[model samples]
Target: METIQREMTVFARRARASAGRMHPELSLVSYTLLGHLEERGGCRATDLAAHYALDKSTVSRQVAALERTGLIERLLDPEDHRVQVLQLTDAGRQLLLQVTDSRRAAFKERLADWPEEDLRRFADYLTRYNGWTPPAAG
Candidate 1:
């Protein structure tokens, strides 16, 4: 368990550093938020906060920054007139595509020498690990 934790920490740090190098203006949080917005089409700030287990204030700050940079915009939710949902703009989508491509290329290069079976096993392990959820707080 300790080894797993240490490896995950190192992996996260390297991933963040790589993402920073790819886009100087984007933090890992913002990049992840943008990805979420893209996937969901649109969702409320509160929804993002809940989904990520993040504080509303932190999500609000990132949303405000994205809004200012024209990466994301608030739109009135069709089903809920009182709620505003965040959506990515064309620029946001384009930037995300570029970043994703860069990341994929980097991963491919890093894993070029790995055997196919090793890659498959590693991917399966990652999926299983990601799917595990902690018990709810009592």
Candidate 2:
């Protein structure tokens, strides 16, 4: 428990520092949404809201900000015009790559002295932590 808590704190500090340096508009939620869009190609606002367990209005606002920055593009789904497909624009993809690379560089620098076994164990634990079984999609 202590280790997990410490790990989370360290991650938070790193993320906060990076976000602060990157832009005043950046937040944890923004980063997370960017990640989802990057991974999923295009997503609906409804799906994003459901997955994040957030209010539609809040997600809409975040999407608005991303759109304003040209990070994401909102499109009407071809198959279903009623639904929106939120996709990362080219700028957004580039930004994602840059941020991920920067974070990795910083993490690598910090873990330079760690033993290989410790690094492997940490990676295994994080993989497990990130794995989740979603409830049936509606």
Candidate 3:
């Protein structure tokens, strides 16, 4: 089991390196944060940081980068002027769509031989593990 786990870690790292080359300048953390916003439509910066267990400063930096790139816009909260809201712009949405497609393609390539059951089992175990594990460090 240790050997298998070690092998999987190496494989995962190689896969991530490949993906990084295939998608340059795309920060995994940034992508992940954007995904959450995409899933929830839009959310407060504070709420997003809390949900992801990330530092507010880290989240803020990422948000600022996205905003500078015109990928996202920090809108003034209508109900509460002090609170800021984050929302994806058209470019951001399109970029996410492209990135999602690339990830699906890559996963399909990597798991081409695995049976449906194997895939399901892997996903199930990952979901179970994630439920208990704390978020990764920033």
Candidate 4:
């Protein structure tokens, strides 16, 4: 268990570091938020916060920074004109794609030597790990 925990921490640290190398302006959090927006076809700030279990203020700050960088914009929701949802700008989408491609290439290179069975097992383990939920607070 200790080994698993330590390795998971290492994995997270490496992911954060690699994110910086991929794009100076896009931190891991920023990249993740942008990816979520793209995947969800845009969503409210509160939705983002809830999905990530992040503080609303934190999400607000990140959103502001992305807007300042012209990477994201707010659009009125079609279903609710009074409400606004966050969406990536064209620049954001392009940058996201570039970083994604770079990350994918890097992964391919890094795992090129791994056996196919090992890769499949590793992938399944990751999926199972991510699917785990903590017990409710006492």
Candidate 5:
């Protein structure tokens, strides 16, 4: 368990470092938020905070930054005129696509030497690990 924890920490650090290399302007957190927005077809900032288990203030700050950079914009929700949801701008979509391609290429290059079976097992383990949720605290 300790070995797994240590390795996971190392993996997270490597991912963070690679995120900077992939796009100097996009932090890992920002990239993650943008990806979520893209995947969900836009959502409220509150939803983002709740989904990611992040503080609302943190999500607000990120949303403000993205808005200032023209990467995301707020639109009135069709179902609820009182509410606004964040969506990626055209520029954001393009930038995300570019960064994603870069990351994918990097992964492919790094894993090129790994055997197919090992890759499959690694993928499965990652999926299972990500699916886990800790039990609620008493």
Candidate 6:
């Protein structure tokens, strides 16, 4: 377990570093938040914080940065004029698509020589590991 933990930590660090290089202005966290917004159409800032298990302030900062970059915007919820939701702008969608393609291409190049079976097993293992749920908090 310790070995797995250590290796996973290293992998995560490297992935983040690679992502940073792919887009200097976008942190992995921000990219992830953007992806979530893209996927969900629109959501509240509080929703992002809760979904990512992040502090509201931290999410707020990221949202603010994204807003400044013109990647995201706040819109009034049609059903509830009092509420606001975040959504990606056209520019944000385009940027995310480009970055995603670049990342996928990089992954393909890095693993080009690996056999399909190995790749399948690796992906399955990652999914299994990620799917594990911790015991409920007391």
Model 4: residues with Cα > 4 Å off, grouped in runs = none
- Across residues 23-132, which tens digit of lDDT does each residue of candidate 1 receive? 99988899999999999997999999999989999999999999999999999989888999899999999999998888889999999999999999999999999888
Predicted candidate 6, C-alpha RMSD:
1.2
Worst 10 residues of 6 by lDDT: 127-136
Q: List the residue pairs that clash in candidate 4.
A: none
lDDT for each candidate structure: 0.94, 0.86, 0.84, 0.96, 0.96, 0.95
TM-score of 5: 0.95
lDDT of 6 by residue, 1-138 (tens): 999889989999988998898899999999999999999998999999998889999999999999999999999999999999999999999999989998899999999999999999999998998888779899
Error of 3 at 102 (Å): 0.3
Against the hidden reference, what TM-scores do the models get?
0.95, 0.80, 0.84, 0.95, 0.95, 0.94
Q: lDDT by residue for model 2 over 1-138, one digit each (tens)? A: 999799899987978877766556667688789999888888998888989889999999999999999999989999999887999999988887877776678789989999999999999988987786668889
Runs in model 1 lying further than 4 Å from the true structure = none
Candidate 6 local distance difference test against the native: 0.95
Model 2 regions more than 4 Å off: 1-10, 132-138
Error of 5 at 5 (Å): 1.4
What TM-score would you give candidate 1 relative to the actual structure? 0.95
After superposition of all CA atoms, the RMSD between model 5 and the true structure is: 1.1
Per-residue CA lDDT of candidate 4, range 24-129, in tens? Answer: 8899999999999999989999999999989999999999999999999999999999999999999999998999999999999999999999999999999998
lDDT of 5 by residue, 1-138 (tens): 999999999999999999999999888999999999999999999999999999999999999999999999999999999999999999999999999999999999999999999999999999999989989999
How well does candidate 3 score on lDDT at residue 114?
100
Off by over 4 Å in 6: none
- Give the local distance difference test score of model 5: 0.96
- Write out the backbone clash pairs for model 1: none
